[model samples]
Target: MLKRVEKAQQKWGGSHTVIDNWLNERQELIVLYCKIAGFSPYEKKDQSLPEPSQIQAFCQILMDYLSAGHFEVYDDIAKACEKKGLESQQLANTIYPRISDTTDIALDFNDKYAEVDAEDLLVGFDNDLSVMGEALEARFALEDELIDNLYSNHAD
Candidate 1:
């Protein structure tokens, strides 16, 4: 996704403020997820960091990453549509913004960890996996619809 954003910037040749904004939105959600999952020093790194080998850290990262990707991509498209005066831009509002998604992630973390002591954060990792899996399902469905629309009126 970062590559795609960079490529878009290179192709367009201007300030990629929209891409930067989108990426920043995702970064915040990831930091929030790290906080809820008991990962320390949840700072966004300048360089790509090594993946945590721990289960809970891995799950939290995966979920937040997926959620962030969703937000950033849709936000970019939304901005594009808005620029073009297209009604489809309004669809972006149908889904929760990045902050809302962050809150949902924190709530999910708290709920799953409520009964368990802080020592067993891994117990809730499966829940995050399930949530992310469902999100992927929904994303694929939307992509399918988008593909259908794109091909539906093609020249014969």
Candidate 2:
């Protein structure tokens, strides 16, 4: 997951400020996720389920990333597509609904963990995080395709 995000950042990093910011937020989210999951290079000092604060922080970044994509990055893509012609617009149309499905998954994750007390967090956290990770991975791929196809024409 981290490798994929890094690849995306390398591929599209400096194309636009909005994209740069969005991708950076993605990196942050993934790092926190890795830490929480006790993944390689981020093994926790204590093996307990992640602290509520960590979940809250992750959710905050998650919401920010989602908002920036919808309100800023995708808005720019839509505007660019208008100028890029019908094909670009059609590509955006085809991709947008799929991305929204991933968004729904991420939102469900946020609702599940954003404010749960410590005891409540343990019930299905591993499964929930695993699901969230998959949704995030799918979303990143959709986002990369959105940029590669739509923004390629918009490049100056």
Candidate 3:
């Protein structure tokens, strides 16, 4: 996580990298919680663990945390798009829906798994966070792409 944080810091300069690190921290926290509850992401599919009702409070907290993290990044992207130019309207619209989906997933998971205990829920929340991070990283990469494109066009 530290290495990723440093890489993000170097790559994105400041705030976005901090956001990336923040998301990464949540993932680490979830992993630690999983360890505390004695489950592995690699557990056998057929193996059954205890129900989630035993740790409903913790699950809710995690759900909220993840949901907020996602939305925060979404907000950041929206602000960036607004500043990028009038050309960003279409991109913002497309990305907004994706962010909406992310929020919906968070809410749905929180509701559906409301009864889940420490060991009962799926590991997909962690995966979803990772995917979100990657998506944001792609946006960061696009900053570089656009810059290069601008330079190339100017050279033409």
Scored by TM-score, the top model is 2
Model 3, 1-156: lDDT tens digits are 334434544544443563555546555545534542445663446554434553355455556555555566546555655666555545557555554555565566456556754654566645544454454344434433332332333222
User: lDDT: which candidate is best?
Assistant: 2
Model 1 C-alpha lDDT per residue in residues 32-128, reported as the tens digit of each score: 4454434456544442222334334544554554555456545555555455443444443544353345446555654554345344535336457
How do the residues 9-49 of candidate 2 rate in per-residue lDDT, one tens digit apiece?
88888888988988889899999888778888878777878
TM-score, cand. 3: 0.48
Error of 1 at 69 (Å): 3.4
> What lDDT, from 0 to 1, does candidate 1 have?
0.44
lDDT of 2: 0.86
| C-alpha lDDT of residue 142 in model 3 | 45
RMSD of 3: 7.5
**CA-lDDT, candidates in order:** 0.44, 0.86, 0.49
TM-score of each: 0.37, 0.91, 0.48
